[model samples]
Target: MRLSTDSPSINDSKSSNKHNANELAPRPTSIKDTGIQESVLLELMLKHLLSGGVLTKAQLVNKMGITGGIIQELFDKAKGLAWVENRQSSAEGHMRFALSEAGDRYAKQASMKSGYRGLVPVPLAQYSKICRLQSSRRNPITFEMLQNGLKALVLPNDLLHKIGPALNSSRPVLIYGPPGTGKSYLCRNLNATLGDSVLIPYAIAIGTEVIQVYDPQLHHAVDNNNESAQLDLVQGHDPRWIECKRPLRITGGELTAEMLEVQFDSHSRTYMAPIQLKANNGILLLDDLGRQRISAKQLFNRWIIPMEERRDFLSMQSGEHFEIPFELILLFSTNLNPNELVDDAFLRRLGYKIHFDALDEPLYRKIWFQVCEEQGLSCSEEMFQHLVNDYHHLLEKPLIPCYPRDLLGIMGDQISFMELKPVVTKALIAEAWSIYFVQA
Candidate 1:
C-alpha cells in the first residue's frame, strides 16, 4: 500500500522532541519521511517480530529506525488483524509484541521472496531525487577554492591553475605521470577542492529489493553536534539522508570489470549497488589505472556509454534494468603512458590530460627541507648537495618529489632502530639512497 505524507504517522504527532533546523542528521519524524512504501514497512516489521520471537515496542522502533508512535500504530494495525499480539508489558510504558501464526506464515513467505529486514529503506525514486538535487556539478570550484583546499600540499602555481579549470569542467580527468610524481596525491587534493557536501541515503529500495548505500569506509560524515543544529531537529529533516563530505572513492589494481556492475547475492536475495552508484555526486578515482586486472581497453569500453549518456544501466539477475545518474568527477591516475593504455579516441573523451613530471632541482630542494621539517629531522645542505650531485647527478637519476620523503623515511627508520636522534648526514643519506634505489 502507498504511504501518504499528508498524515503524521503515530509517533510523530505525540513526540515533542524536535530537532534543530541546522542539525546535520535530522531524525525522520514519520513513516512518510522514510520515503518507502507502508506495505513494505509492514512486511519488514513482521519479519523482525518473526525472527526476534518477542520484542518490546521501543526495541522494534529502534530496530526499524522508525519513531515509537509509528511502531505503536503498526502494532495496533497488526493486533486488529490478529497478525501480531501484545504478549505482555516488558517495561513500564512498553508492550512486548510477537508475531501470530498468520504473521509468521506471512513473514516466511516474505523472507522466501527477499530476506531484507533492517532500516526502513528510502525508495529508489526518492534516492534519485536527492542525488540529482545534490549533484557535484551544482557546486562549482574556483581557483581560490582549489588553492585553499590544497593549501597543506605544496603545489606549483602552474599546476594549481591548470587543476582549477580542469576540476571546474566536471569531466573525466586523466592524471598521467611517472611513478612518484604525485598523480594520485593531486587527484586527492582536487577531490577535496570540490568543496561543500552531499546527502547520501542509508539504503535504497527498488520494489522489494533493498540495496545498501552508506559505507563508513567510503563516506566521511560531517561533525554535526552543534547546539543550535540539535535544537533545530524538532521539525526534522529526513533521517534517511546523511550529510557527508563529497566522497573520494579510490580503487587500484585489484579492480575488475565485474566490479563495475551491480552485484547480487543469489543466496541472500539482495542487491549491492556498484561503486559508481555509491560514488555518485563526488569523485571516483581509478588509481593505477592500466594495472587493473581488466585491461584499459575493456575498462574504457565499460565507461564509454556512461561517459557519453551521463547515466548508467545496471541489470538485476531477473533481467530488471535501472538507469542511474552518472554525475561524478571520474579521475584516472596512472604511472603508465596514456597512449599505451588507451587509444587516442578514448583520450579524446577526457577533458583534461595533464602530465606530472619529476621535480626540478629548485623544487626538489624545497621538498627536501619540507620533508625534513615534517619528519622532525635536521637538514644538512652539505648532505643534500652531496646526495644530489654525487648520487643523483653523477648516477644520472632524475629528482622526483617522492624521493625526499621516502629517503628521509628510511633514514628515520634506521635512526629509530639504532635509538639515535634523526639527522641528515652524508653517511645516512648514502645509506638511505642505496636502499631506496635498486642497483642497475
Candidate 2:
C-alpha cells in the first residue's frame, strides 16, 4: 500500500493548525526578542570574529543565523566598547569587521567560559512550549495509514489494529516476542506512518549554559527549497530552527544509564542533549530491551516519572534541575519473556503489550515467496514443499519471518562464491538451513 500523496482531510484541521503554529520560529528583530542577554550575543559575535577573522555583515548574519540588523547592532555595541574595528570597504562597498586586541582577549575569555559559537540557541522555555504544541497536535493514526505503511510486512490485521491505537495513544508500547519475529523491523518502519515533520532547533539555552539539540547524524533535514519555504523566509522564519522529519532513534545493547543524562564535553565546554531530548516529537525505540547494560528494573525506575508524567527532568553540571517535554513514542522490543523483565505493576503501566509470535504456515510461505522474488531466484513448488516438510517440520523448527530472507541470503552468498547458477534447490536449502541453525 503506497502512501497517499493527497492533501490532508478536513478532520486534520487541529493538526494543520498546530503545524502552522510551529511552522516557523519568527526571526528575532532585537536582542530582547532573541531571549539572550546582549552581553552574551556580543561575546558570541566577538568569538565568531576572532575565529573567522574579518567578517562582513552578511557573512556574520549567515554565520550566526540572525538578521543583518542584529549583527549591525552588535557591531555598533562592539565598536563603542573598542572590541571591534571597521576595516576598509571592499569592492562590494561592505565594510569588514575584525576583533581588536581587547576584543580578542574578551573572545578568549568567552571561549574559556563556553566554546559554543554556533547558531544562537532557542530559549529553553520556548523550546518546551514548541515540543508540547507539536506533540499535542499529532494527527491521529488511522487503520488505513497503518496498513499502507506496513504493507510490505506480513503482519496480521489484528496486530495492526492493536499497533494503530497504541501509536495514536502517545504512550509507551511493549513489543515482546521470540527473536527475529520482525519486532524491531516493525518498530523501525513506524516512523514512515507519521508522514509529518517537526521543527528542531540547532541548540537550546538554559541560563548561561548551552545544550546543543540538533545532531546532523540523527536529525535528517527536510528539503525546504520550495515555494512554501521561500514564503516562510520572506515572512521572517527563524533560520536557526530546521524543518526535519520526526526523528527516530534506536539504541539496543549499547544503552547505558549515563546516556540518559545530559552529557558534557570538556573539550567543547558545551552540554549535549540526551537521546530522549533529541527524539522529542518523534519515536525512540529501546530495542533488545532486557539486553542493556542497565538492568530492566533500574531502567524502568529511570523512566518511571517520564512515562507517567509525560515530562522528564534533567540535571546540569552545576546541580541545576530542569524539565523538558517528553513528547515521543517510546517503544520497547525484546526477545525475552516480558514477565521476566518487569513486574506486573510495571507492565500495567504500558499502553499496550503486543506479542509477536512465530508465523503460521501460510504467512511464512508468503514471506518465503516474497524473499524469493526479491532475491531473483526461482523456487518451484516441489522445492518449497521439500523445505517445509523435510527441514522445518521434521526438525520442529518454528516458521520465523526472518528465516526466509536470511536463509536465502546465505544460499545466495554460497552460490556467488561457488560460481553456480542462481537457483533455489533442495540441496542449497538444506545446506543453508544446516549452516543457519545448530542441531541439538
Candidate 3:
C-alpha cells in the first residue's frame, strides 16, 4: 500500500513532539540512502519485471514502494547491463520497460535465493532506531484521556485512575480478575487512549535476510490527503513506511513458543516477524495468560529480558542475533490467580497489578440498561429485578459485566425467532437465563 503523510490524531498530548518529528522516515534520495546494496536493488527490480512482464516506470515505482527517480536510476543501470530494454511509451507518456533474456535468467536465480518480491525493506538499523525513538517519545496518558477513550464502557473512576498512571509509565501491566469481568474488552479499548499514529515499515532487512513486519490484519491505515498534498509540495513522504493507527494485537490460549520468534520459510527463504515485533509502538495483550499452549513459566522465561530491558533479542536462521526495541505496552489479562501462575519474583517485575472483580448492583443495572438500549429492546425495571433476585442472587452467580450483553443477546434472538415484539419480559428473562447459565 502507498504511504500517506497523515497528521497524527489531534487528541494526542503535547508530549508526542519527539515522536511526531521523526515518525516519518525521510524519503531516501538515492539508492545509497535506501540503505540497500546496489546488487540487492537490482535483483528486486529484476524479480518484479520477471513476474509482471513489461511494466511501466510508474508501475515499478508503485510496486517497489520507492521514488520514481530511484526507479529511473535502477532502470539506467539495468540498461547498461543489458538486463532490461525500453518498450513503447504508454499513452500517459510514461516509459515502459521489460527484462532481457539475460535479466530473466538472473531473476530466476534471485528467486531461487529468496522469493520475497514486495516493497524494498528498511534497513534493520534504521528500523531499530525508529522503534526506540517512538517508544521513548510516547505521549503520557492522563486520567481525562483514559476516561474519554473508554467513555462507552461502564467502569469505576477508581479503576480509571489506576489504569491512567500505569499506561503513562509504559511498563508491563498485570490485570488479573475473574472471567467475564471485561478485562479483555478494557485492554482492547486502551489503544484509543494513544491518539497518535505510528509508522510501520512493510518489511525490515538484515543483510540479505528479509523479515515482514507490517500485517494488514493488524495495522489499520489512516488517510492523510491534505497532509500528503502538502508534503508532496515540499518533500515526498516515504512510501516504504505506512502511516497507521497504533496497532493492538492479542494472542490467547493458542499461543505457542514458536510464535514468539522469527519464523523462516524454507521454500520461500523469507522470515515472518513475531507478534511482539509487529506490535512495536503499540500494545500487545496476552489474553487468558495462564492457559497458553506453552507453560506460564516458559512464557515468562522467554520474555523476562525483554520485559526488564525494554529490548528483545531475535536471531536469523544463521544464528546471528540482533536486538529490537521492545517498545510497546505489554498487557497480561487472566481470569486465574496471578500468584498461582507465577511466583512473586516475576510479578514484582510488573509495573502494576490491578484486580477486576464482579460488578456491584448499581454498575450491573447500568450495564443492563445500556445493553437493552443497544439491543433495541425496552428496558423493564420489573424484569431486571426478577433477573437479579431470581437468577443471579438465588443461583449464587456473580454479576459479571458480560452477563448483561450475553443474556440480552439470547433474549433478542428468541424474540426475533418467535416473531414477537422486542420487549424484555420476566418469562423471556427466565428463558434467556436458563439458556445462558447451566443448572446443577
lDDT of 1: 0.76
In model 1, what lDDT does residue 183 have?
86
lDDT score at residue 374, model 2, on the 0-100 scale: 95
- Candidate 2 lDDT over residue span 302-330, tens digit each: 99989998899999999899999999999
**Model 3 weakest lDDT span, ten residues long:** 225-234
Q: Name the better of 1 and 2 by lDDT.
A: 2
- Candidate 2 off by > 4 Å: 1-24, 224-233
Write the residue-wise lDDT of candidate 1 on 1-440 in tens digits: 00121234435522311222124345665667666777788888998988899998667765676677677667777878789977878657656888889989988998887777766787777677666656656546666767777887777789887777777675688999889888888777766565555667767887767787778899877634221322122444554566667788899998988889878777887677789988998889999988899999998898888887778888766777777888788889998989999889999988799889877788899989998998899977888899899999999889888888999999999999988878888878888988999987
Residue 222, model 1, lDDT:
62
- Candidates by lDDT, descending order: 2, 3, 1
Clashing pairs in 3: none
Which stretches in model 3 have alpha-carbon errors above 4 Å? 1-23, 224-234
What TM-score should be assigned to candidate 3? 0.92
Candidates in order: C-alpha RMSD to true structure: 7.1, 3.6, 3.9
| Candidate 3 lDDT tens digits, 248-278 | 9999998999999999899887789999999
Q: Which candidate, 1 or 2, would have the higher TM-score against the true structure? A: 2
TM-score of each: 0.87, 0.93, 0.92
